[model samples]
Target: MKNDRRPAGHVVAIASGGLDSTTLAYWLKADGAAQLTLLGVDYGQRHSVELSYLEATAKTLDATYIRLDLSGAAALLAGSALTDARVPVPPGHYTDVSMRATVVANRNPLLLDLAVAHAVSTGADAVAFGAHAGDHTIYPDCRPVFVEAYRRMITVANEGFIAAGFQVLAPFIAMTKAEIVRLGTLLDVPFANTWSCYQGGRRHCGRCGTCTERKEAFALAKVFDPTGYETDGG
Candidate 1:
């Protein structure tokens, strides 16, 4: 007997439990565009605790929650501040030079592979994630070129198995974090439930690149941020 945990839905959304992804979930649901399966990936990140927020988001959205653990890859993906204990998480603006240490080296392709595989396995038509404009500066994989090529590559990768009209969606691709925050405010996304700390501390380190970016996003959007930062750095 084979176990089948493949995500089954009109769209399997990768939920990172961060501001962008959580907002994406709420937006998709409220937009009434697609049936959602909130999928969370755990590649032994320092912030595995974010999965709990992901589960909370699933419940909030009343969507299927798939927590896929690829923790074994942590060893192979060492040196990244997120997966390596030795490398300290960088504290600065997200796009600054120091923040490059957070790159997991082809991380998005690996994560998106899960969405595609599950989409193919369950005959789902689409796979979605919340890669936004801010991600483009640091993450090569988050760029439109990569996403478009990835969609095509995956289509060819499983030509027979994939559903017709299958799509890899990154709706926030062109939008800024501030814009997303504004939209999330309109969507009533519980911002406090999202997690962005790379430190995985009791509260957001607030000094890390992501936290700084998160604070900046809220400020730029003129939205009141509910997140509690340990350092009050940003």
Candidate 2:
């Protein structure tokens, strides 16, 4: 069923070139979004290869691609394994204790703010991102409460503007990653082009929390994953 809450107009998607975000982009396109803009943030994370995927995805979807430089801010937000080389990217399932090392502070909030601002500037009616139920346990920003609060804040902040009725859309907020995979598969998303490894090697390490989760989601969804992994072992 199509979400009636989603306004019918230009929409900006926070694309990270990961499974979730890429899937979201494809979903938007499938839903006949008139004007779609993909916003990618370059935050100097270890998995910079995803930026390449971001570009490719934009081309595939025929959407305008905009890259924002947040590398300077990443320096101050160091200490997380993703942005700091000194810290090791943890290997295990997402629920493991060690996976907390990968959290970047206020990542979702910062990215959403940028996406929302871009939408406002472009006269877009909505801004979307892929935040699923699985992330709620590890990322507070991905939780429903945070998203609802952010939506309210954006509504209040844009008051009186010509295109003031902006929406923060998280279509998969209550769905599991496996469910997202199934939806993406149905939408024929190019999964092979998406990147999820924190190591940022030539191929996915297949050991990091993200890689593990990606593999698990595919398995749970019964979808054939086309991602190239460095190792056969999960």
lDDT of 1 at 49: 87
How accurate locally is residue 165 in candidate 1, as Cα lDDT from 0 to 100?
71
Runs in model 1 with CA error above 4 Å?
Answer: 1-9, 232-234
Index of the highest-TM-score prediction: 2
For each candidate in turn, give its C-alpha RMSD to the true structure in angstroms. 5.5, 2.0
- Pairing residues by index, what is the TM-score of model 1? 0.93
> Candidate 2 regions off by >4 Å?
1-4, 162-164
Angstrom error of the Cα, residue 72, model 1: value is 1.8
> Which residue pairs clash in candidate 2?
none
State each candidate's clash count.
0, 0
Candidate models: Cα lDDT each: 0.85, 0.87
- Across 140-230, the per-residue lDDT of candidate 1 in tens digits comes to 9989889878878998999888887777878889899999999999999999999999999879988888899899999999999999998
Query: Which candidate's lDDT is highest?
Result: 2
TM-score of each: 0.93, 0.95
Model 2 Cα lDDT, one tens digit per residue, 59-178: 999999999888887797788999998999988787647767888999988898888888877789898989998888878998888988888888787777527556778999989999
